[model samples]
Target: MTACGYRVGGQGASLPTEIKVIAVPAFENRTPWMRLEQRLTAAVMQEFIHRSRYRVVGKEQDADAVLRGAVTSATTTPVIFAPETGRASAVQVAVRVSVELRDRRTRATLYANRDFVFREQYEISSDLDSFFEERDPALDRLARDFAASLVSAVLENF
Candidate 1:
């Protein structure tokens, strides 16, 4: 009972407490990026492990629910324009993801949302080679932060 004079386990009650395991499937990527799926999947797994009360399982059969996600967009655009040749002075990388939560046993959707965007800006470098190399580290950081935010939002009932 939750102070409402209703049994917690009966109909019209609050959500059940038995759902504690989650399976994160490989995210489908609609973008041209070849490895975004792997990156996003890894980040989501890491976030769930770090901050959530639920346990993450690799197999859907082992979990109470499964979380399906898709990377809808990944793009890089010039943020600043160079005055000399009208070239990009800096670049911004953005990623958009859509997520769905479903019960594995009942096959019922619990939640779904889209257009979760995460972006990061990087300074332009004199050499293109160094720019690409440095981009990985920044992207990794951004992915981790984005995953954390997503997980927090889901768990907090947002």
Candidate 2:
């Protein structure tokens, strides 16, 4: 029980107590977006470091367990269009990811999710000068949201 008397699902309630250190390597990018894996991997590592008691390491051999992930698919689709120019006014981005956490010593899988999906919607600027400017920031926000959800799910053994 927590101080509030009700425990949240991701307060390391299900994670093994012995897992004091974790390895988070660069996620594999199976999508066409270059360096997407790097961004996701970095976000996940940062989340683990900031949100949990586990120490994060770059190498698998130095950790008690390892968390591996891959970005499987990414797509951007126009969801809303401007009435005047018939151009996309808003777009929706969808991403699929695969994640796995395993114990190095016991060779046991702690958590596995092969089809984790995440989506975000961003407004497309009407001005040509700022059209592409929203993309990176949108992706950054998506990555952070994905990391938070992924960390919670992993911690809860969901």
Candidate 3:
């Protein structure tokens, strides 16, 4: 009988075996939104710490590998509107990023994506009292999601 080479499931750990420490710095923000980089960078660091086997550092000088990124663009557009008031009831936020993972010792890029785009939709509460409270949390959720996807892509080397 001929044997097929198909594997069972995901074979993780595509990074080099020598890479044990990773540095993740605050990504540069080119968008109009304030503190977007901070939130996204923090989320990525947290994801690596929680999900990966590598030790994460703040400075690139102290790590075996570096993950760098930039927030290239951000836009908010109304997706849903209130029928009675003819005003926006929900908004879709789209963020574009450029990310790269490089090996410090080898001076080679392990992974790079120049145009990673992520979008999330959030409901704009019609109640004025709770309106402002929803913005930060929604952004936080989006950042977390982006972080997870980025880390997965890097680890899987896709």
Candidate 4:
């Protein structure tokens, strides 16, 4: 038997059945950060393609299952202060993601988890370039890591 307990179509050879296709919906961002929805959606889609057995589908209607996620919290805190200027030298940013997997046809949840936190530190730049430049990159990376972990957890349980 394969990992997923299915045999190959013709050969009686055991092979894991592919998840094949999934849909990721735009995540709801409760934080003040506006672009998190788009960034997280993209990250989850990429994770499905990269780390999982599933192929990400462009449309929800086309998918066998749907993976939905939300950004429950995104926060940044000054961790280190420069003595000379009393300015923040380093900041720790954390992103919390909640995800659920559901069968598209039955609308039944297969797996669900909440408050998966991913954190990263960023150095304070001397000059302010843009808010997004400072925040979005780290947030995106956190989201991507969270997605990867989530996928692994779900697959392992199966």
RMSD to truth, every model: 5.7, 2.2, 2.6, 5.9
Q: Could you tell me the TM-score of candidate 4?
A: 0.74
Q: How accurate is candidate 2 locally (lDDT)?
A: 0.89
How far off is model 2, as Cα RMSD?
2.2
| Residue pair clashes in candidate 3 | none
Instruction: Estimate the TM-score for candidate 2.
Output: 0.92
lDDT of each: 0.77, 0.89, 0.90, 0.71
Candidate 1 stretches with Cα past 4 Å from truth are 1-16, 82-89
Q: Please, what is the TM-score per model?
A: 0.79, 0.92, 0.90, 0.74
lDDT of 3 by residue, 63-152 (tens): 999999999999999999999988899999899999999999999999999998988888898888888898899889989998988888
Best by TM-score: 2
Clashing residue pairs in candidate 4 (N, C-alpha, C atoms within 3 angstroms): none
Instruction: Write out the backbone clash pairs for model 1.
Output: none
**TM-score rank, highest first?**
2, 3, 1, 4
Better of 2 and 3 by TM-score: 2
Q: Between 1 and 3, whose lDDT is larger?
A: 3
